[model samples]
Target: MRKPLLMLVLAAALNGLTACASAPSADLGSAPGVKEGSTPSKGSTLIIKDFADRSITFPSAPQKIVALANGEMDIVYALGGTLVGRPTATVPAALQAAQSVEQVGSTHGLDLEKIALLSPDVVLGNHPLNTKDIPGVEGVGSKMVLTSANSIDDIKKQIGLFGQLLQKEDKAKELTQAIDQKLQELKTTPSTAKTRVLMVYGAPGTYMAALNNSLSGDILVSAGGENIAADYPKLDNYPQYAQVNTEKIMKSNPQLIVIMTHGSPEKVKDGFMKEMQQNAAWSSLDAVKNNHIEILPADLFGTNPGTKVVEALDLMSKRLQAAK
Candidate 1:
């Protein structure tokens, strides 16, 4: 079943750093030493340290795998790894051909029974959402590897680590190198104007603003756009994002507004515009007056676009240039 776009957006909004509790450490089980550059031979015992510093051991290279997150699924596909199960969402175009893969819940929840039935050798997931199911996944004899990515550097590291896990280090290196090169090229790309942008995720009534520290905010800054939401105090309720304040937005007068939505981009943008048009304050906003509004692609912006980071960056750069 394809995952709903709104649920995916809400999942991303709730998965920010502040929404999660501190991860508990686990004991490293008996396993062979596997360093950063060490390649694991098939059937060799391999040990991996996850994002939360917990160690997990695999008795052998994982052939049948389950990925509970979009980013993890993307990495698996990018490295030519097969998936026995994937979250019930629209996966990247490259992996759409694997229609036989079973739906294994979503970022908001997991189907432990379905996952166990798959008899996967390894299960990849992230913190908080997958926290409660970690032991259960291990109980089913599947090695659970938790991963995280909040910045460009973290994304690069994850690509390298996933490559290591799949024994596709060469492919991982090539992908990361290409991403680095594209990012570097963007840095030198000349822009005659800089637009203060308000990056948001939500529907009409409910909205959240991305801060400078968030992945989308970081990408916007890298693409030569300024995030106006950065100046406001962080929301205690959502540290990575802020409540949309009309007064603050009016005062800031962002020149461009970028909406990240999971549903039909046209419908979402139209709904938001309709709501804003009802308010005199919103009508006076610079972005509204100049009509500098854009809807970001859900595939690239809704979740952490793993190997597609460069593509996301390129899109943002082009939009920023056009807005100028």
Candidate 2:
């Protein structure tokens, strides 16, 4: 009887071991339907509404990011988010260390292959990026967030959006507050004169006028200067700027000419001055006659002024007040 009892006990232990072996394993450190080890438990799902009015749902806050626009990059850096990829050339001096990050491409174009390899969680850009490229970016499992900033109010909104996306609302509030404070100060400062200013962006052989809708033009108006390009017909492909017309410029006879360039300010100014000198019609313009031509600092004007827009406004206000 004792031997029989021992056999039954041994059989029960073996059956228990078999049941334990067949049991399902626990999925450690993973959310339901999410891949194991994919994201941290602290991360929360977020819904982002982009400039295009499209809603994008992020499984979690983006850990790897690619900001294709200078403004986007600036806002991200200001919020203390790390960039996995960025445009190599246009990044500001304060964010120069970002150059060490991967080069995804510029606002003019994107390298789909390199971007794919990086496998960024989110790619931030504007409408200028081809919609056709969306599939290629999505093919690599990356989401694109399109954004724009045509005015100071838009910039503030974008700052808030990025703050929400990056979970950096405190930093965003601080930055926006500082920008608002500066803008308030500008509003209180008395203008020396109501000057008609023409803002132009210059490349080696190309020039374009900033319309009232463009970043510089909007700032120019806010700073108490009149934008002469306000009435210029917008370019078909580039609505923010208008084609440079020497005839119209001569006709406008702007009291101040603000030249914005990404290259050497002196060289750009000399080129415009030389072109003006050759055209007797341009010579008669009030700006040329009064030597009111000024090259805006590249950081504040060459691209979207980003968080430094207040500086641009102050600089323009000072210059406009000082102009004869």
Please report, in order, the local distance difference test score of every candidate based on alpha carbons. Answer: 0.76, 0.76
Put down candidate 2 lDDT per residue, 1-324, tens digits, no spaces.
Answer: 656644544454354444322112334432112223333233777666666555566878888999886778888988989889987575678778687888878767887666766879988877545444555566566777776778887788778778877878789899999889988887887656678888988876678899988888888888888887898899998788998777778887888999999887787778767876676788788887888999888878857767888788889888787664
- TM-score: model 1 vs. ground truth: 0.84
Q: What's model 1's overall lDDT?
A: 0.76
For candidate 1, write residues 1-324 as lDDT tens digits.
Answer: 334644543444345333444434444542212454445776687666676566566776689989887778888888888899998887678567555689998757877667766879888887545766666666555667776666777788788777877778789999899888988898787756687899988765567888887788888888889898987677896677888777778888888899998776777788767766666788787777878898898878857888888989999988887666
- Candidate 1, position 147, lDDT: 68
**TM-scores for every predicted model:** 0.84, 0.81
**Candidate 2 segments whose C-alpha is farther than 4 A from its true place:** 1-42, 264-267
Candidate 1 residue-wise lDDT at 57:
64
